[model samples]
Target: MITHIQGRLVEKNPTDVVIDCNGVGYLLNISLHTFSQIPDEESLKLFAYLIVREDSHTLYGFSSVAEREIFKLLISVNGIGASTARTMLSSITPQQVKEAIAHEDVALIQSIKGIGAKTAARVILDLKDKVLKVYDLDENEVSVNKNNTNKDEALSALEVLGFSKKQSERVLDKLLSEQPDANVETLIKDALKKL
Candidate 1:
């Protein structure tokens, strides 16, 4: 297995990169997330995952080990292939993917291009526990940071009070952006005023 490659970045594109390691040039497939994370410098090092098939050997590269682990986890699903996994990674940040799975947000998962409702549900069902375990994610901490636990709690309370989820989310997002340190009571009160 090619764990990683450290060399000069000979070429760079959105979908792929070529690294010159000594005398050999290695081509690596990459996602947009990795492409954006790569630094514009002569020397670069990328964590790699090599896929070996009967007729082909492909190398996928990631800017971070976390992204690579997420990719591996995505491909472990029954219907998800390497390309699909790459597309998912390209479509969203690794943290978003993890949160969506942990929260069982089927609509969020299905919103990604090329993913259907069935596939999205399967992804959540198959990987929810694994994601929770691998990422050590607390269910309560899935969607909000400690500083914004109030925001999450308020959102749930609003939902239970029959507020539309989309409207509540927008209201919460705006409020959180403006006042990141707002407490639960303040968030809920502000959200109620907006709604």
Candidate 2:
């Protein structure tokens, strides 16, 4: 297993990079996230994962170990391939992917270019627990981050009182921005006035 490569950066591109270690040059496939993180310097180091098949060996590199771990987990899914995993990583940040899975946000996952509803659901179903466990994320915390627990509570209250979700969100966003420490009561009150 080519765990990592550290050497002179011989070439850099959006989808791949060539690193020269000693006299050998190694080509590593990479996602756009990794591409952006690659520094414009002579020396480079990248955590790597090697996929060996009967016909060939391919190496994928990541800017951080976290990204690499996420990549490995994604590729472990039944229907997701290395290329698909790379595409998912490139389409969104690793943190976003983790949050989406933890929250079971099928729509967010399906929004990716090549993912379908079934695949998105399968991803959430198969990986939700694993992601939460591996990332040390609590489901409650994930939901809180996704909707901001206080804001969500306020929004729900407003909606029950006949306020539109869009309107409620707008007002709540503004209130939260101005006073981030605002509690649910304050958000609901301010939002009612605005609405």
lDDT string for model 2 (100-176, tens) is 88977665677688998689878888898899898788777766545465776787799899988778888888998
Q: What 10-residue stretch in candidate 2 is worst by lDDT?
A: 143-152
Candidate with maximal lDDT? 1
Tens-digit lDDT string for candidate 1 (1-195): 889999999999999999999979999999999999999999999999999999999999999999999999999999999999999999999888988888776656776999986899899889988998988878777655544446557877898899987899899989989998898889999999999
TM-scores for every predicted model: 0.74, 0.74
Q: Which parts of model 2 have CA positions greater than 4 angstroms off? A: 143-195
Candidate 1's C-alpha runs over 4 A off are: 142-195
lDDT, model 1, position 151: 57
Candidate 1 all-Cα RMSD: 6.3
